[model samples]
Target: MIVGGAIFQLCWVVRDIAVAQQAFTEQYGVADWFSIPDVHFGTESAELRGVPTDYTISVALGYAGGQQLELIEPRDGVSLYSEQLERIGPGLHHAAWVPDDYDAALTEACAAGIEIVARGRFDDIGMEFAYLDGGSIGSYIELMRLSEEMKAMFDHLIPAGFTNPWQ
Candidate 1:
């Protein structure tokens, strides 16, 4: 049986990662947790079933109220986020959740009628993700699971605002 996890992070899709990061820093007084350049994988080209085509993705991480915030920018062609940005102008993209049995959970979600919008594996992070159609929810949803190595990496590189006062 697949054990579901809580919402891990909320993603904000933007056109400019630097501007977005700076805005967040200035507005919320939060520093960037980490920023990664465009990372490519698998085929050089692909298509989103119901969404637009995209090539590369650039991501930045930040924190607010004890929750991680992911910022994504599509570098290649049009993408799901491109449409989202056109409609809403760079804001919340999706809420992410982690599941113990990612495959099983995906299967169950499909069985229950949630459509898979997009999916890919982040080789550097040792994690895979799937975006689900939200229907009436007005937002996409992400399902993700991390490998042990990735978990170790996260533990080693703590985000800036995570200092423990007692320590």
Candidate 2:
């Protein structure tokens, strides 16, 4: 296993987050999405292919069984999300994990020959993340480390019955 555990989230890139959310709710039984309509990943906060890049996206997050489901609508700027949406119009984009040791886990992935396509820190939320190339799998692998505050926020947003194991 790359991160040595179960995947916590699966994300899909889409043209419209609202439509995608409805489709997922109806087709895959995922309901109760917590949406953030405008998220700005500025050049100061993000990178693409090791170079500073900016992007904006709207996302709806929910749960499907035990895993978190994310639907992203690329709004502006060049990013992995936008690129994937262009290359393979609106579908599965990545599988993700929130490992306990972020740096160590990242180093291990790099040592294993997984290329780091992008990495950045969301200082406002005390979170850091990276996207690793999933060449053979035809998707990216996301590794994230969240702060206690962010975990608490997620816990609050999740429906009463759902769980966030990482939190």
Each candidate's root-mean-square deviation in Å? 4.2, 1.5
lDDT of 2 by residue, 1-167 (tens): 45767677899999989889899899989868999998899889999989999999998999886678899899999999999878878899898888888889888988999999988788978988899999898799999999999888777766667677674
User: What tens digits encode model 1's per-residue C-alpha lDDT throughout 83-106?
Assistant: 787788888899887776788989
**How much lDDT does each candidate structure score?**
0.73, 0.87
Global Cα lDDT for candidate 2: 0.87
Cα lDDT for residue 68, candidate 1: 71
**Window of ten residues with lowest summed lDDT in model 2:** 158-167
- Stretches > 4 Å off in candidate 2: none
